[model samples]
Target: MPITTSSPPIRQPCPPGTCICNRDALLDNPAADPRILLLTQHEEKRLLARLENCASLDDLRKLQQRMEQQLGLRTEITPGHNEVRSMRGIRIVVHEQDGLCRKIRQSIPAAIRRGLERNPEVAYELLNEHDLLRGT
Candidate 1:
């Protein structure tokens, strides 16, 4: 069985601010071109580290803002929270820190992937080669 890709590459003019990754190159040769993976891994570490060190809501907000500026993502901090009911309708309190953690886990990977798609070169520079981790 062959892997079939469905989305046809659009040849129409690229919008002014869009940068399309040469996905064909990436898909054809991943390990041979280690840049994209390295970049993504680095961004993931940076974002996760920042998220972990957030001491308060304000700190989290600042980190989220920085992420937004860097990657065009708006971190939605639903302050003064409420309860999320489970499938069984049991209300689970949403603590601010827990919410922040959830956001970090979800957003960091997304931001990393977006960063890779946009700027793999920077990503590779930021990551450690032997470990695939973020380089300080």
Candidate 2:
């Protein structure tokens, strides 16, 4: 009897300007990139509200951990030394090689607008509570 083995199939290159290959690559290793953390509008609103409700650095830290656990997105919160009651800075770290960071940044304004349109008073209250609303 002759010994024979089948060769592995070759992968064809994806067409130009198409994301078929990229999508397949992501499907193969979803955990390799944090771009999966992209949030829907509803999720963004809920997260923003939760952020606004944080009363202290401890609260913010807890929220950060929750986000990391639930969304796979890492965040850092920095409280101002002079202002013990407020979070002065927040950084959301993610892989930027694939433009996910820019996409998230660009979506913020639209999300806030939608939130404001849905409930102006609640939106204002949340933003003001977090010292994000100017001249309030």
Candidate 3:
């Protein structure tokens, strides 16, 4: 018989955010107010590193404030419309019936679910690729 070898497993694109890797993590929580914030891998890493190196309570508070702005929550609520702030803090108003917001909400959860099924080893690979893991 001729000797044959299987090809290596195909790599997937890097997923955003921390994945809920196991059933235990999925079953462990019942939040009072359930919400999802979808962030990319780099964004999550930056958030974690910043949290670790916070200089003082004041720094921590400032960090929180900055995060709120970054998350697009630092906006005035006007009734009956969806309001988004531009980079220059100008308000861009859109109707509540806009499909873009709905699509965003739906897509994020789907992406997270896809992330849940990713191979566990991929996490290590991600850390390695980003140089977050060092010294073996």
Q: How many backbone clashes does candidate 3 have?
A: 0
The residue-by-residue lDDT of candidate 2 on 14-116, one tens digit each, is 3456432253455467566533334544576677776655454455557767766755555433223353332222222332333123444434334433434
Q: Score each candidate by Cα lDDT.
A: 0.41, 0.47, 0.35
Instruction: Give the candidate number with the greatest lDDT.
Output: 2
Candidate 1 vs candidate 2: which has greater lDDT?
Answer: 2
Return the candidate ranking by TM-score, descending.
Answer: 2, 1, 3
TM-score comparison, 2 vs 3, better candidate:
2
Better of 2 and 3 by lDDT: 2
Residue-wise C-alpha lDDT for candidate 3, range 1-136, written one tens digit per residue: 9999985332122233433222233225554111123334455556556644544434544755674555432212121223222222212232221111333333333332233224323334433444545678
Model 2 regions lying over 4 Å from their true place? 1-25, 28-35, 79-103, 106-136
Q: What is the Å distance of residue 119 in model 2 from its true position? A: 21
Better of 1 and 2 by TM-score: 2
lDDT of 3 at 38: 32
Candidate 1 overall lDDT versus native: 0.41
In Å, residue 20's CA in model 2 sits off its true spot by: 16
lDDT of 1 by residue, 1-136 (tens): 9999885332232243343444344446645432222224456577666655544445555765675554444444321223312111211132222112343345554543454335444334333332344445
- Model 2: ten consecutive residues of lowest lDDT: 83-92
Ten-residue region with minimum lDDT total, candidate 1: 90-99
